[model samples]
Target: MHSSNLRLEEPIRMASILEPSKPNFFPAMTKIVGTLGPKSRTVEIISGCLNAGMSVARFDFSWGDTEFHQETLDNLKKAIKSMKKLCAVMLDTVGPELQVVNKSEHPISLQADTMVVLTPDQDKEASSNLLPINFHGLSKAVKKGDTIFIGQYLFTGNETTSVWLEVDEVKGEDVVCMIKNSATLSGQLYTFHVSQIHIDLPTLTDKDKEVIRTWGVRNSIDILSLSYTRHAEDIRHARDYLSKLDGLDQTQIFAKIENIEGLKHFDEILQEADGVILSRGTLGIDLPSEKVFLFQKAAIYKCNVAGKPVVVTRVVDSMADNLRPTRAEATDVANAVLDGCDAILLGAETLRGFYPVESISTVGRICSEAEKVFNQDLYFKKTSKHVGEEISHLESIASSAVRAAIVVKASVIICFTSSGRAARLIAKYRPTMPILSVVIPQLKTNQLRWTFTGAFEVQYLLCFSSCSWLPLPS
Candidate 1:
C-alpha cells in the first residue's frame, strides 16, 4: 500500500490531546523558521506566525540597520509575551559578499549592449556607465571575458530583473563590462556570480564580527547563521569570535551551504557548526539550477546521519505574492519533510509576503501530513546502522528509548533535559511518536538551548531548592 494512502494516525496516540491540562502542546515535529521583515515585524503578524507554527524568528542583517532590528526584536518579545510561546531568534549575518553600490536614491537603468565600468571603490557612486561593488579585489578577481550576473540571484530567484554583464577589458582597479541585458539595477545586496570562478573572499567580514559583538550580543540571539560558509575554518572563526562576546558563547552557529566551495567541504563544515541551512536559491545561482535539488537532498541526508539539525530554505518562493503556493511548491515542502529535514525556513514567504500567516499555516499542515507518511522504522534502522558498534552511553539509552516507545506503541516519549543533549539524541533516531522535552530552569541561558533540539514540544519545569516539581505558570 502507498504510504500516503495509509492512515498511521489510528495506531499512535497523542498525550497532549488526551490530557486536559496540556493545551499548549504543538504536535508538528518539523519546525518552521519565519524571517522577520517589514511585512511581518509587527506584533500581530508575529503572534499569528507563532500560533500558526513559527518556531524561529530570523533577522536578516544584510538589509536592516541596528535600530530597525532592535525595534523588530522588541516587537518579537512583545509577541512572545502576548502569545506565551517560546520562539528562538536567529541572527543571519551578511558574510563576505559583494554588492552593487548605487549612490543615487533611485535605481539606475542600464541599456543592453552598453559599456559600463565596474570598480571596487566604495566611495565611487554607481551610474548608468559606472557601477561600484563592495569587494576591494573586484578587478583583481575577474579577468577579461568573465561574466558577472547581478540582481535577483540571492534569496529571490526572480530572473526577470537580473542584469548580465560580460567583462570586456580589465584596467587598473576597474573592469569594463558590457551589459548583455537591460535591467533596472536597484541598490540592494545581490549575489555576484562569476561562472565556475571561486572568488577568494574571507568567510567573516569585519561587519559580521561587529554585528556579533553589538546586535547579536545585545539581543542574545539563539542562532547565528553564517552565510556562505566555505569550510570548517569559517565556522570556527565565527564560533571563536562569538565566544569572545560576553554572553554569546552558547549561541548556535548554523553553516549556510550556498556555493560550490561550501558543498565541497560540507562534511567538515557540518562537524564544526551546530546546524546546517541549505540555501537552495543561492546554491542555484552558484551551481546549475538543475543540481540544487540534488545538493539539497545530499546535504540533508548527511546532516541527518550526523544527528545535526538541518534547515531547508526557499521551498515556497512563489508564496510571497500568491496566497496559495504552486502545486510544485507544495510537493517540494512535503518532499523536504519526507527527506528528514528538521526545519523548513520561509524566506520571502514570511519576510515580505502578503500572506505570511497563511504561508506558515500551509507549511505547518504540509509538514504534519508528510510526517505521518515518513518511514520512521526504516529510517531508524538506517540511522542506527550508521552508528555501528561504537556508540556513547547517551546514544545507547536514546536508541533504547526510541525502540521501547515503538514496541509499546507509546503515546509520547517524555524526557527531562538539562542541556537538551539527551533529547536531541532521541530525536536523532526519528521516532514515530513526539518527544516532549521538559527542561529544568537551572540557568537562564539553558532555555534557548532547546531551540534546535528537534523535539516536538518543549516545556519548562519549575523546581524549588527542595527538588519538588511545580506546574509551569500559565
Candidate 2:
C-alpha cells in the first residue's frame, strides 16, 4: 500500500522482550534516561542502555573531572557509531553550588545549639572550627532566622536532624550562625538553604565553559542541563556563553530547578530554557522533604501548561543500592507519568548503582504500567490551556490521520515525515491507535521507537541529512 522505494527499518533487535513488529506501545512513549558512570560508561554498557529502552544518556558533570568525562563522551560516541543508534547526550552542569571547606583533615562534628561561623572568605580566627563556604555573598543574602541544612532533610514541617544552621548575624563575608541540628560534616560538596537566597557566581564554571567548547560542541552533545538554576539570567548567561562557541543553536538548554528560587522563577527560566529537570535530591536539601512531592507534581503540571518538556531525576535513589526498588519508588515513577512528565531521569541508579541496566529496565516497565491508566482524555483536558487561532494544515492532516486510523481500527498510524514535524503532531495528540511514523535518518534511531519517538516508524526515506538510517530487517 506504499512506495516500493520506501524502506523503514523497524529495529528487530530493540531493548524490550516485546516483539518489535508488534511492540507494547504503552512502554515506548515514556523514555528511560540513564546516566553514564563507573558501572555503565563503556561502549558495551552504553549500548546496553540503548537496547534497554533508554532514550537519553545523561552525563553527570558533578563528580567527574574533564579527562574522565571526555573519555566517557568518546566512548558514548563510539557506541552510537558502532550500533548505529540515535541517542541524545545530556551534559549536566556541576554547579553554582556551595560546599563546606574546612582546614581539618577529618570531618567536623557539630552539636546542637553550638555556634558555627560560615564565611565566604577564609576563616583565620578559628582554624579548627571554621566552615569556609565556596559560594560567595552568603553573608549579604541571609537574614536572622534563615536556616542552613547540611545533608539534612526537613519533612512535613519537622526537621530530620539537628545538624542544621540558623543565621544569627551577618557582617561582610562572615555569616554568624548557630547550629540548630547536630551534623557531622566533611568536605562534601553541595549545600541546601532554607533561605531563598541568590548568590554571586557564574552560571557555568570556567571548566564548564572549556568543556562546552570541547566535548559539548565538538562531541555533538544534544542537551546542556544547567544545574542549580536560580534565575532566568542564569540561562541567558549560559546561552551567551554557548553563543560564543557557536553552539547556541546546535544544542538545547535544560534548566534544573534545584532550589526554592528556581521553583519560584520556573516561569522565567522556562521562557529561556528548552526544557526543565526536577532535580529532586537538591530540592530535598532546600525544602521540606514532604513538600518535594507536592512541588514535583506542581512543576510537571505547570511545565505541561507552558509546553516545556520536564524530566524528573533521582526518582529511585534507593535502587542505587538495592537490586529491586522499594514499593514507594515504583509509585513515585507512576505518579510522575500520571503528572505528564516528558521523561524520567535515573541518576545514581544508572550512574553508580549495582544494577545500572536493570534500573533503566525497571523504570521503563513502571512507566509503561502507569501509562495504561494515565487517563489520556482527562490529561488532555487538564493540560490544554490554549489553542492556536489558526489550525495549520499540518495539524489538520495529523488529526485526520489519527481519526481515520481509529475509525478503521488500524493497528498503526504510519506518517512519512520528512522533518519529523508531522510525526510529532500526531504523537502529541496521543491517538489510541499505535503510530508507525516513517522518517528520514535526520531523526535518531531511538526516535524510531515509542510515541515520543517510541513504537513508531515509517519506511526510511533517505534524504540530505548528515546521518543515515541503514536498512535493518523488520
Best by lDDT: 1
Point to the candidate with the largest TM-score: 1
Q: Distance from true position, residue 328, model 1, in Å?
A: 1.5
lDDT of 2 by residue, 224-292 (tens): 899888889989988888777743454668898988888888888988886788988768767787898
Evaluate model 1: give its lDDT.
Answer: 0.78
RMSD of each: 6.6, 9.6
The residue ranges of model 2 lying beyond 4 angstroms of the native Cα positions read: 1-27, 81-84, 102-105, 122-128, 152-163, 180-194, 246-248, 285-291, 382-385, 400-410, 432-437, 441-474
Question: 98-189, model 1: which lDDT tens digit per residue?
Answer: 77866664677889999999888868777889888877677777788887888833545464567888999989988899998888766544
Residue pairs with backbone atoms closer than 3 Å in model 1 (clashes): none
Q: For candidate 1, which ten residues in a row score worst on lDDT? A: 460-469
TM-score of 2: 0.77
Task: Provide the overall lDDT of each model, using Cα atoms, as 2-decimal numbers.
Answer: 0.78, 0.67
Each prediction's number of clashing residue pairs: 0, 19
Residue ranges of candidate 1 with Cα displaced over 4 Å: 1-27, 152-155, 188-191, 443-474
